[model samples]
Target chain A: MADSDELFSGLYQAVLSGDEDGAARLATRALDSGHSALETIERALIPGIREAGDLWEEGEYFLPELVTAAQAMKAAMAVLQPVLGAEAKSLSLGRVVIATVEGDIHDIGKSLVATMLSANGFEVIDEGAGVPVSRLIERAREVDADLVCASALLTTTMPRQRELVNAVRSAGLRAKVMVGGAPVTRGWAEQIGADGHADNALSAVNVARTLVGHRAAG
Target chain B: MEGLRPKLEMFTGEEADRVIDHALGVLSKVGFLVENGDAKALLREAGIEEKGARFHPPEAAVRQALGTVPARVCLFDRDGALAADLGGDRVHFDPGSAAIHILDPGTKRRRPPVTRDLCHLAWVTQACKNIAAQSTALVPSDVPESFGDRFRLHVALLNSKKPIVTGTFGTDAFDVMKRMLVAVRGSEKALTERPLAVFDCCPTAPLTWSELTCQALVDCARSAIPAELVSMPMGGATAPVTLREMVVQHCAESLSGVLIHQLACPGAPLIWGGSPAAFDMRHGTTPMGAIETMMVDLGNAQVGKRLGLPTHAYMGMSDAKVLDWQNGMESGIGAILAALSGINMISGPGMLDFETTQSLEKLVLDDQVCGMALRLSRGISLDSAGEAVELIRELTVLGNFLGHRHTRASFRREQFLPSRLVDRATHDDWEASGGADARDRAEGEVRGILARGNPAPPADDLGRDLDELIRAEARRLGIEALPEV
Candidate 1:
């Protein structure tokens, strides 16, 4: 293989194998050899991550491998992003602000959703647990977030999810509100006027993407 | 004796010690926040440093707590008979608990279970030979939320002779339950000596002990009632994603519970127990039947055994919404794992939908599963007297033992004769019989048991006294009548 082909293949293997340092090193070497950042990302990093996702869906890889692969892609992107400039925004599906709602300290569901979202190419901002309705809306506005996801494990805290939706609406934020947790059912989401609800984390990505698509179309 | 008992170990001695060391570090460095005032005082008395509500007990204090707790806890039946020995390799099975909804056998839809539903559940649990104990399976939706726990205890006491594994909703409810226990066992002294039930007190996951649970733990310890500390750590969410990390967190949480209980009363009976499971990232459900969940149970039980304490776990349950094939597979797998692991009290059969729903049919189905698991746990006998060598020699030429007396005598002990719920008929016979699945047969069995009447209803006068107690409690709680049967 040519030197450039070998470099691309090296970057691909690094990302596929979840070697963050190697991915960053190969991306740096490729850039130093006068290779365009866009080509390196499109030809090497993206394909590697896509294959990792495929392996994950096919059960050949688990969460650890998928997470590490995502980490490796992020490492490569760190080297290429500055040079790519405006093109970096196109790589992520959408920006999401996820948090466990106020009065509820449970964050496992929210964190899982955030991880799944990030693994699927969405830029996720985890606000942590006990996030008030006002803070979620404020953060969404600050990040220009396309989706605000609120999770609550307790039945008592589920009403706070509705409050989140109302808070976004009253604040006149353009972001869509999504609610989920052990108790937050789809009917409850509709009752609270949320744009979407996901029963679990993996499907949360699809729901977020569809919400983003709807926003773009509308 | 140790060699005779079949056991499952997830961690070696060195690994278990490491996990304990890590848990001790967590207790010291990243201590839990104790919201209860009395609990804070007790921890302070036990040499736990306090920073406002946060408590960091020293490793010595935890070891002391473990030392003071009795290695064995024997629960007695309502008649003051020893029902279960929850220690060593002794294993018991109970239905899953605290379910808000009951899967209606007739309609097959989830609905709020009434007091009658709880009674029926207790009755069916009593009928199951393999179900060693009963539980407060359903929170009777008809009762006031304040009195639900007490009412569940009342119904279980009236309907079942077996000792119950139950929990309280609040401190006040715990007091009421203690009174109900007193009513059943005749007096507070008798109740304490031969406790008819064990209270399952849960600490909030990720090392947080809430005020209510802390209060319940203290009460159980003080009253000499066996307290089963259920520290449910959801892996990958509230706890570490790795099973080992989750086990470490579970150790910390359960160790904290032991500290509180022992501080309340030294030499008290405390169970090292939990219901930890991997957080299913795919659909975000904490599946009870996940193999990882069973491994956590086995691993945690091993750690508990290393400390010489009785163990408990929430296993033999499924996340499936219905009593389908998925339910059978999950429940059966969990049952076998928990039994083989020799957990003292395996409490999670008959639960579905992440343990939110209870089904009588599922309970019947799980009874069969428990029977099979128990038979397997009995292991193979090596009695030279009954080795069957002579019988085999005699039958070597004929190739038949069916006509021999040894076959007739040994079959009952050696073979697991499954119930009708487990279909063994040929395909053609099955189709001719009705083509009913396990669920269908289970539903039929549930109807038969309920229709046959409660096998052990409380006697007339005692029943009246129990009724009066419930009514008085209900009236005190500002309710008019006990939901009529």
Candidate 2:
């Protein structure tokens, strides 16, 4: 039998080099070697990609490089989807359906959160740009999503953030919600009844995780 | 019907003229203080005499030099369409200036930015259609050399087919930029009449310019390039605590710029431009999102419009690091206001971190907003906005307007339909389509733009000359020429 440890290291290196095929191949080999899929992903891929994050912060890397590495890691994760089905539950980060609210249609900030969450082990259900409050709530329920990340860039459209929160309540899901964008602040987040707030993408992940934990504890 | 154009009298008038005249008197007599050595050297080359602490550009010499400036210019595009008309009512957008650092990979911290960064930034700007003109993100010093002049010319080569808005460091670069402009418009006279570039000459916050800016006023004027007298006054920081006082300082500095510039080159196109804001006491940062920032943006343009001078202001920029709701609100409102106000050449897109960092996402988003704002200036036509009553009638109580002739005609061009920015579908439709949200769509959009390299060819052979001029300059400054990424 092949050594799972060595196979896992290969998965890490493939992702770091942005080789999607290599990463998926290595990920499958490790899975076949009877290595726990969750263990391989958590110990190998997560740490390796986060190191890329560190490299980015250190100025030794830029966005193109980070994005490439993230892409490869996501490719590997996608390959593991069918095989790891029920076993994936324990490793899964609560899914958050993220979108920008209607009447305002900028989405890059919201995408960053999706990336961050996906990298951090979330099964992010992205309702690509310009989601109406009604759709956002319905999608969150359909995905069994624990959180909804609503981003609105325009002041004219900021009210839609609040409308999403209200729509969630009216739907009786009251799923933990978070709001962000250029005009959004902690004050506005509270005003709109979001369960949590993230000032940026990095914070959004931690906040999303914490919100889910809080709801589960309740 | 009263047009949507902003009223100049409400913001500036005879009172502005008097205040500006007083400020000019202060400038002629007291002059300005200088601390930076290179700025000092440039001033001396431009004919200012340094007297210990001050560089006194004789008011007459300043006026004499100002006489050489040209007053009007028009930039043509690759298809010969009008791209931007400087020294006029057109409000064109450009990138941010003088970012000292970018997020570094090796250290996870910011360090001194180098020319390679500038080259990358230039390329990035080139790829972006929203960038009507350009600015250097930083000077090249990756290996430590005198690349200031070469850097300016290089950026002109890399970014603009439209007339450039740039500046120089020393007398040596004056001709280099001149050569570069010649390369763009195709003649020395074209540089003057067609107006390929506008040299930025800034006044120190509050009331004065160090000797270099004053000397630059004269030099830029004599050079026959339009000079943008940018005032960066902040309420309660480097300026008086009041917004009015900040405006006064801005007016004063601009008049002082005009006084010296007119002296050097009279009737040259001098724009009143600025990056004014209120100082946030809590954070010790200038709040570019503050109401005062908008006031300064609107107010200074008012001052220039009153003088019948071309205007520019550092507006339409969000301090937001990413394209979030706050980013949209700050940038969308600010940019829309800038267009409606009738300020010519508003320069702030792709600006972030209080004018220190640049984000690709923010830049594209800003452009989308810029598209919407520019359209705002055209005003909603009565013919097209569709008779509201008629539209209601057309929509017979139960019938949908989805495939209506009016809707079909107007949907594609009249409305600003966003890609990856907005959603316009039923809930079920949104859910079925990857169920992805705006952010997801934006992320995909950003990935797409960067992946498909958008390269515009150099406007002319002058672009090649500009490149050579800049490379020669970098070598002379002891810096390696930036390599194309």
Candidate 3:
């Protein structure tokens, strides 16, 4: 077996290289070559990228550099995701379909949530930017997705994010509707009848996991 | 029925007078507290007397002290060319207004804008005629990282052409921007004498300061980077509940910045830019484009204009995402009202998503809207029965003036023509043309701009040195293995 140290070193190099494509290639190769996906992630990928975030916070790395390194590490993880199942469980902790909902063309928030979810080992089907209600539901059903995470930031678009939950309900796939964004709040979540809500990307980790748990028990 | 002549402000003469009058009231009765005893004396000698912690400045003296600050200043590029007339006519899209995401080309993900993207944005803005100045978009995250060279790269990449409005890293951000200006201009003295950058040093409102804000102000004043003192108070939350109370808090905070500007270097221009939003009690969010917010918006500028302070207010943004009916209604109304109220500078255009996201399409769309708002403030001309006269005459003759020479001459110049933003096309045409909504088209446009336009980068040698400098700065800050710039 190759030394874990060498593997970690390559991962770190791949991250700093801002070569998302290269990092994904190496992650897949590492998985195929008998190294555990979780190990590579815990030992290298997450740590390497997180190091960049820490550095950025410390003023060592600025925004462009930190963002690029995160992209590289996240890209690498994208490849290993399919191979990340445990012996007793499914390939994903949760099946999530996330999108920036209708009338909300700004997907920066949705994009961040997707990346963080991808990092935390959630099987995320990211419907590209500006997804309408029908498409979000159709995709969720197609994937048999456990969670549909909708993001909206505008006062006008806030209704659309709420509408996703209703559309999913009408389609009879409303069992696990999740909604969030700057305009979204705990009160709004209850008002919209959503099963789950996360204020930010980090809390989204726990929320998605909890939703998946609800699905499994059901 | 004209009552007064045209001032530089296009707001109706009556409205402009009221705005100035309101600002005078704020300056006098609620005179801003001079933080230092010496500066307190300056306000007093100018007939601004103190009682307890609060001080009151009479209108006459406040106007004279304000006279010390240049009402109008011109931004100049490295080549010593005029960039923009700061006080009127133009609304410059200052680069970087607190964007958290840098969309990664490879991953299609959103992450913090790094040094490279910050510099890349700077280079892009430097080359962009639409963008008059550069701002350090929320680098690596919030304003907390001002101490890092993130702010330095922001100024350096802007070195090519764009006159800068950059913040320094930490309290030393002002010093760093000056040094960067020197690097580009080839003289420290030149930068100090004719500052290229305007430091947007924001004071934490409701009277508080982190070490960084306090220090940045002092250095920014000392360095002579024309500083716009921005005080943002989220009313009912950050400051007092009422709009008037909020404006009072806003004035006090901005006045602190003015005091620093005078104390550090007298005669240095300091603007009264207060971005106070009325907080929505139910949600704990500031509805930035709400009517109450705009009321505070008008009042904030009212106070500034009255004090003869170069007025700046947070205006021209919507809480909506797309170019939907709501986006148009909210932003159009808010922006026009703010402009007609006679605000000199307005920010938060192209802002969206409860004021978090920045849409390039919204930016372009708002620019067109700003054009409309500015023209609207000019009001109607009564001199010899203006625009309506010729059009009405045409109606009596040809039934349509569209084919007339008068129509042909005025159409393009009179109206703010939008390209690809406003869907004037019929449903059939819109659908036939890929059915791309404004958002899709905007996304396509953003991609096209990024792909086709290459902003001139810093010289290769400077680029290398920049990387080394960032690495060294990181090492000192204890972040290892920073990716390439």
Candidate 4:
């Protein structure tokens, strides 16, 4: 059996390269080698995803690379989750329910934000595009979500973000509502009573961390 | 080409001489406090002595410094192309700099800008036809406060091909910012040969030079970068209440900057520029859009030109919070007057709310305003009068000159056709387009320009070097990750 450093590097390289099969294989190897699932995740998978996030922010990695890395992280998580059981819950930064507001079918921005949030250690529940505000709030309540993010790409559909914020508040949910998209601005976020706003996917993770009261990574 | 150009002169030649004389007198009698030790040492080398904590330069020292200063300063784009030529009667424009907040296009309210906002601004500036250079327009709140100065310049170099008009905050900021420019320009020598930026070094009001600003001026001169002296003298507040005294004070401060820069490195490029405002006693604010402020700017530039040096002014900006009639009135009048006065570089196209906020929508709208001002400065060309008479003789009989070849050949040159931002359509046509207001139209234009993306992104190797340098600096400052551009 490989030593711990070599085994962890194998998993990290697997995730960084977006090789899902290799990630699952290395994750199992680490666990079979007497390493706890939490140690495997903390020492291997999380560092891999954070490096990918850094590369994406540095402009060296594109969207396709980032999306695939997220997939590899998910595959590794699938292999490790059962052993960790409820301890898996503590590994995530927070639970976030993300969606595009109603009447807006633009999914590229929302999907990118979801992938970024997930890679940055948030347990992202992506409800996809054109989701109604009521269903979004309902999903947040179902997951006991810490944050709910809504994206509206058009000027006409932007008011839906405001609706999501109001619904989340009126429902007496503890989830912080965050807004974004093509036409959304920090001013719009303030006007609609959102907890925070991010202009792009990379910053979305930081905003989410801040909203959930986590110490944001430097 | 030889036709007389329309011009606006705030002072006659004799009056300009009188202003310079008064400025020299002020420098000699009431010396400016030199905050930086090196700057004071340079002045001492030039036969100026510090008395009572001030450096009182004699007339000969000022003259010697003025004699070596270059009359023109040229700026190059990121790809080493000539972007703007700042010389006699040549008008170039860039947006205002260092705004803490940006006016959101969607909500029309002001908020702190981020990296993406600054990158979008660089793309917009790259696409503008009349705005020739980019400014470090917004201070991104996401970056560490110490990194803001170089980070703004880094973003501009990455996203735009135009030369940047930028500045530094602290004494230590100039070196790293210069390194970024050097990387883009291939080497320090290459950057010096074709300067990619002009650093705005501002002296505080009331004849005091802060240590940081004085150091920036020294660094800019030594690096062969153009140092734009921005002496902001507010009438009735920091300066004398009267306009003439305000103008004289502006001159004295600017001349002191010139002396310091030239004493550091003789024949270095420097621009005689200012953002002086007429203080409003009623509100205790400096109104940049006031006519009195514009006069102070023009008077200062007039002195700069009389000294045979390049000139700059902060004009064509509004004090209005939103795009409205007041915005239009102030922006238009300032642009026209600045152009007519032949200010070499105008630096306030997108500023609003007393220069604290920048609106990208207003920036696109102001591009058209600058276009019209440039057209007006061309005046009437009498080069083809005989041809015009012949066409008139032929068209008088037919009563239909629309199809005339002469009209066809001259219409494009004779007219300045504005973009969709200027509403020239019929009422029905306007309504057909959803009756969008100027703000909406401006927003659409900004979207279109940004959609086109960066026309002149840096090359891959250059881009990588820039990223590595910025990342290393950010890490040194304890910023593990910077927001993507």
Error of 1 at B21 (Å): 1.5
Ranking by lDDT: 4, 1, 2, 3
With a 3 Å backbone cut-off (N, CA, C), the pairs that clash in candidate 4 are: none
Candidate 1 lDDT over B64-93, as tens digits, reads 888999999998888888888999878889
Pick by TM-score: which candidate is best? 4
lDDT of 4 by residue, A1-218 (tens): 45889999989998887778899999998889899999998998889988987886665655556666777888898888899988977877999999988887788788878877887788999998899988998899999999999999999999999888889889999999999887787778899889999877777888899999998776
Stretches of candidate 1 exceeding 4 Å from the true structure = A1-218, B1-3, B384-388
**In order, how many clashes per candidate?**
1, 58, 16, 0
Answer with 2 or 3, whichever has the higher DockQ: 2
Model 3 local distance difference test score = 0.63
Name the weakest run of 10 consecutive residues (lDDT summed) in model 1 chain B: B398-407
For residue B321, give model 2's deviation from the true position in Å: 4.4
**What's the TM-score of every candidate structure?**
0.68, 0.59, 0.56, 0.69
- lDDT tens readout by residue for model 2, B431-481: 556887554665565566556543545745645666677667667677654
Global Cα RMSD, each model: 27.8, 16.7, 21.0, 20.5
**What docking grade applies to model 2?**
incorrect
Evaluate residue B149 in candidate 1 and report its C-alpha lDDT on the 0 to 100 scale. Answer: 87
